[model samples]
Target: MYRPPHFAVDDLPTQQALIRAHPLGLLVVAGPGGLTADPIPFLLDAGEGPFGRLRCHVARANPVWRTIGAGAEVLVVFQAAEGYVTPGWYETKRETGKVVPTWNYALVQVHGRARAIEDTDWIATQIADLTALQEAARPEPWAVDDAPAPFIAAQMRGIVGIEIPIARIEGKWKVSQNRPEADRSGVAEGFAAQGAAGAAMAGLVRDFGRERG
Candidate 1:
């Protein structure tokens, strides 16, 4: 992550918030077979370590869990809102025509050592917790016990659990913080006009800009 001072977010709580909001992370690992990347939904235990602990799972057939040895370093990238910002959004575009297009986004990168767990109890608890987290917002929440016991057991047998105790974490929030106040406000307004797709970035721009002031 190339984090300029203005775009850097070093606060632990802020980074954890982004991860919780966007639980799906890109898991990257390097091993004897080379590098592999997979999109996986994660559960974060913020109090587990200095940074945090990440829990996820992979299909048993997937080589990722098998290729990486115990304590191998891995990266999990959690990306929140992101959008393209046109130069037209900057007030400077009108003043001096010097503004260029850029991207505005909020993301967190977690570096940790992974541990593969085959314990059925651990995997069962992991799946239950993950399910609760995702289903809590639903009108009728589902649970592991909602299905037949044998069916659920068979399904669980096909996956392996992965745990990572975070060694370091980095957060980047490039939401026009590098721009001047007027330019940042212009960008926010431009994004606001875009409706739902732009709402998150617009809020980020406003929040980060206020922090700058």
Candidate 2:
């Protein structure tokens, strides 16, 4: 992730929060066939390592886990939020007509050595944790125990676990931080008025500005 200083998010807590909120990540690996990317929902255990540990499962039928050795290096990419930013949204556009369109977004990248887990017990626990995390906010939360044990066990057999002990972590928050305060404010208000596509990004921009203060 090529990030400029203004857009860099070096805070560990913030990065972890972003990962937890946006759990689905693109897991990429290299193999004899070539580079492969798999989108999988992950569980981030920040207390497990200096940076953290990431856990996810891939379908047993997917050849990725088989070809990419357990010791292989992998990168998990998580996209938090992103939206198109029109130049007209910047106050500078009217002042100098020098501004161009860009994008406002937040993302995190985790790099680590991945290992495959075939142990049924480990997979079972992972399934439970993942299920609980995702269902926590639902009005009617679901749990792995809600299903028949035999059925759950059978389903688990079709997937394999991939664990990454985080060696490196990077976060980038490009939310108009490079622009002047007036311009930044304009962007936030502009995004807010743009409806769903920009509403989330608008909130992020405002929150980021508050942090800077």
Candidate 3:
């Protein structure tokens, strides 16, 4: 998370919001082999810890479960992203010189201590909890019990649940914040002129300046 000063996201509440909105994330950890990363949907488990925790699961046979990795550090990157800033978007292009293209996006990185929750009951509980979190927006949602007991038990046996206690959070939002005001405005205009999500995100980045910072 080597963030330049201008593009850094230092606000705690904003970081939490980004994590919540983008609940699905990339979970990365250095393991017995090297570094392993899994694209996972997680529940941001917020409670007593000042920084909260991350909870997710994967298939037990996935090989990420074989190690005894309690207390090992992990990183979860939740991305609230928009992309592909074209060379045509910079205000500087009109002003002085031609600039190479660049990208614009937003993301939050949470560093944490991780452990495999080995107890079946604990794993089941976490599954139930995570399922609820995913189903929160549904009016009539499915439950874990939708499957046959034997089938679910078999499925559960194939998966492993993980818990990560977040220790440090580093969030970076590089949505033209590093640019001058005219350049930022130019990017936003360029995005809007194209009628894309990038423009919408540019607006968000602008509004975010007034809020998060």
lDDT values, one for every candidate: 0.92, 0.90, 0.78
User: Comparing 1 and 3 by TM-score, which wins?
Assistant: 1
Tens-digit lDDT track of model 3 for 126-207? 8888787778789987788887989888878888888888899888887777666777777777777766655667676576
TM-score of each: 0.97, 0.95, 0.87
lDDT of 2 by residue, 1-213 (tens): 898777889899999999999999999999898899999999999999799899999999998888756699999999987988899888888999998899889999999999999999999999999999889999999999999989998999999999999999999999987788888899899888989877889999988853332
Candidate 1's TM-score: 0.97
Clashing pairs in 1: none
RMSD versus native structure for model 3:
2.5
The root-mean-square deviation over C-alpha atoms between each candidate and the true structure, in angstroms, is 1.3, 1.7, 2.5
Cα error of candidate 1 at position 48, Å: 0.4
Q: Top TM-score: which candidate number?
A: 1
Residue 122, candidate 3: C-alpha displacement in angstroms: 2.1
Q: Which regions in candidate 1 have their CA more than 4 angstroms from the true location?
A: 210-213
Weakest lDDT window of 10 consecutive positions for candidate 3? 204-213
